[model samples]
Target: MAAYGRGAGVAGREDLPVLLVAVLLAAAACSIAQAQQQPVYTSIYDVISNRSDLSTMKRLVDGLGLANQLTSGTFTAFLPDNNAWAQAFTAAGVTEAQMLTTYRDPATTLVNFHLVSRFTTIVNGSIYNNALKISDLAVNSTRSYDTEAGRADSDYGLALTRAGNDTDGAGGVQVMGRSGPPALIAANQSDIAAGLSYCNVISAVARFWFDTYFDIITKSSVTASSASFAGLVAAGGQQQWLKDTTLTGTLFAPDNAAIAKVQADLKLNFSTALSQQDAADLVRYHMTDVPFNRSAPVNPVATKLKDATLTWNGGQFLSVAGTLGRPSNNVRWVGFPRSASVVPLLDAALLPLPSTAWKLVVAKSAAAGASASSGFSSFIKAMEAQMVVRYQMDDTSKVVTVYAPTDAAFARLESYTGKPFASLASAIKDQIVSMHVTQGAAYTPSGLLTATPLDTMAGSRTLNVTRASNSAAGVQLSGGQTPRGAAAIVASDNVMYGRSIVHTLDQVLIPAGVVLPQGGGGAAGVASAPSGWALLLLVALAVCVQRWALAAA
Candidate 1:
């Protein structure tokens, strides 16, 4: 009898509400597992095979050479088809160089801002909001997840539309936007309306797109000849040499203009004075070593040429400490031939560099050549002890906003005459970095909406808003009447589209002295960064639950 009772009790316990709870938990777990399945299409062809946008899809695919990668697995491509390319095509007057060199693209930003770590089905609304996801990363391409507000603003199906690459008829070209249309009419309209208002911004930030995070051969169409400073003159076995060098060996193969510059500068015959070895060093000076697409080493130590007289523009791009700026043209790597390559016979002339003696054999001695400061410098002195952002991989996806000041801006700092760099505190004593410290990427705009706030490394900024000659709110940056403030935003939203951002500011800002800009990093005083542990934990818990459930079953 005792045995029977015990057995009965155990059985009852197993069948009680506890059993119901376990079953429900199992179902919920399964749902989550399904959610994690992610979207997978073996190849782009697979998607095209079933979709009606055949011809359109093919053109874009060929342009990007995405098919090869698609064959391996599924990908959530930020598809910007011909139409997308075209819209920019008309507005595209913003030269690829400008786009690559300046401005920001919300869509492109999302593509890079978020990661493809695991397959993420980024339906539009999956990422959107005024609230930025990676707070540490001061990018405007933030994700706002508020469904109601987004839907109210017609945010729902937005992500879904992007996934579908939806389109509308307004645009003569086919593309998609938050509203879901095959036409780029919306983007265009926005560009048109906000364009002039933020033309500088778009041009600068979009340069991010042009900026390479990986090694690339920045090329454009050119006859097998010399035409510009950035033009190539490789031929025969030399062409092989061009192909042999790593991407870091930027071939400043002079365009006619650049070649002309070199001739004028050195009194040399472009045809004979410059040898292939000399060409190599010219290319070397044009390139500061990077892992292919890696962003310019941050606050890279002050560079000095051991040999030649080539100089880097000594100014921080219109960028903050934690961003990639656009003043990168000063350097280029040689190996890569296509990705960000821009080739053209300069309409004018080009220049050349000395190789054997100027490059490898000697330490870089050029005061102006490739010095980290010349790449981009926003303040009088950015870092008290210049530094470098250590990187292990090519990072063409990174972009920084550089706040470049003209030669005069620095000269205005009186103390620069000869006194040691001023400390970051005293307005007149020492304040090298304190001068160029605006937070967040300030896309250069010739000018923009009167209200747009300009963030500086200062973390918070004071905009002296203005409205033409009418409103008092107009900006007054760098000693000018800016619609924004003390920060004139000479060029607003200089979008560094793909991987880099470079903006040329008229004058540098002052960081109120030693007030390190927001999120300063390095051996410097910047504090430890925020942790990604929460994110890791979240992912782990999600994974563990599935494993446990599978094992139990």
Candidate 2:
């Protein structure tokens, strides 16, 4: 149970047993070296400081000279921001000063909970390594019930360890002595606890809970030293371009092991080759260009991704054990210390690519029509009247993704124009369409592409996205902006707009230059007949007839 729910973020797993620990460590070190020599980071420090969301966090990093060590640590931090700080204080029912004074030991303990000396953050989540430090883990073996003592009859020969937050004598994690409150662990214990279950693979978890964990082993860490996108391409110049995409998209990179499996399946090179699109798809699949959180799924519908419909209540073991009439529920378990004992494995499969979600259009429509008051056709008509101003629909209109402008937005527009919107012609209609109709479906930031160019009826507009930015307010299309000018999509995906999908903008965008030429074809005119041609033809015929008559006489 200790290892079951802790920091589990899966990139890819080989069907066979994982490689030996020594093999992995060497790989991790080598992989990190290559990344630094030719970095994936634009400015490593920017990402690092932004993680803390603190202006002072960068100052702290500088003071500690922690940049190099952190980059080298193979660890990830679940940094909290100013807002997170305020929320933590609010939840604790105490000011930051009061908490510092009232719970100094716990405060110290909480800080210790966050700092990790051995762990490093890498892309493909970890599966234990040889660096399983004896000092760090206080593993105590559980006695077997079986009476068999033969060499081949070792039942439960492996240790069944328990874990906790503080270290006991053997240096394993110290289990909480008793359950007073889940709060004592962190001053803002409730929020921290919820965020703890967020996945470990990428940077998205930062948006969900303001904290995240890194595994000791990760795909990025375990990579070969020579690995580089350019090098992979240069080796054969193999890194390929996305067919339609112009820039290098962020990826949910699979490690050598995962790619090796893919290669074996495809029967390609063991090394010196990569399916750039395939690699990109897998990595991007894990990404929510907008932040999509697996941990805080709001409902059963939300859980549809990855088929993780069941809530991970952190007590499955106890519930099962209680049902089975095993030992009392209050026993210490997971890691002999909490840090190493429990881990959570999160599936990135839930968030599919934009193209891939088109496959789920059926599911999306079915779910949309589940209310029983109206069928899909009625739903489509209603949505069309409201959201879309103009567009052609298939005869058996395909389930679509519509960028909905609320009735209120329309109401606002009518007030601005001082004219009724419904009676408008093409010229007038086109402007509204320009603002609403984006090319392709309204893929929330969680979709395949980001920084989508939203086409306005007037002209084209760029609608930026960040992953963590949910439409809690409205128009939730992308992930958390890494900073200003960095709009990424985050949160839930596969949202539908009637038959179509929809992500509304916060406020309807106002474009720069465009004029509406309404009712311009009403020019007055009179019809003219072809009298000149008729008169000329008649005269020519008479002349010919007279000549013929004279010749005959």
Instruction: Please provide TM-scores, in order, for all candidate models, with all chains considered together.
Output: 0.26, 0.21
| Model 1 segments more than 4 A misplaced | 1-226, 229-381, 384-396, 415-420, 423-442, 446-451, 461-475, 478-501, 512-553
Q: Candidate 2: list runs displaced more than 4 Å.
A: 1-401, 446-449, 456-500, 505-511, 515-553
Could you give candidate 2's per-residue lDDT for residues 177-277 as a string of tens digits?
A: 11111112112211111111210111110111101111111111222421432233234322333121222211222334433333343223423222444
Give the TM-score (vs. native) of candidate 2: 0.21
| Model 2 poorest ten-residue lDDT run | 203-212
State which candidate has the highest TM-score.
1
Give the Å shift of residue 471 in candidate 1.
17
Q: What's the lDDT for candidate 1? A: 0.32
Give the C-alpha lDDT of model 2: 0.31
After TM-score superposition, what is the CA distance of residue 298 in candidate 2 from its true location, in Å?
A: 35
The CA lDDT at 201 in model 1 is 6
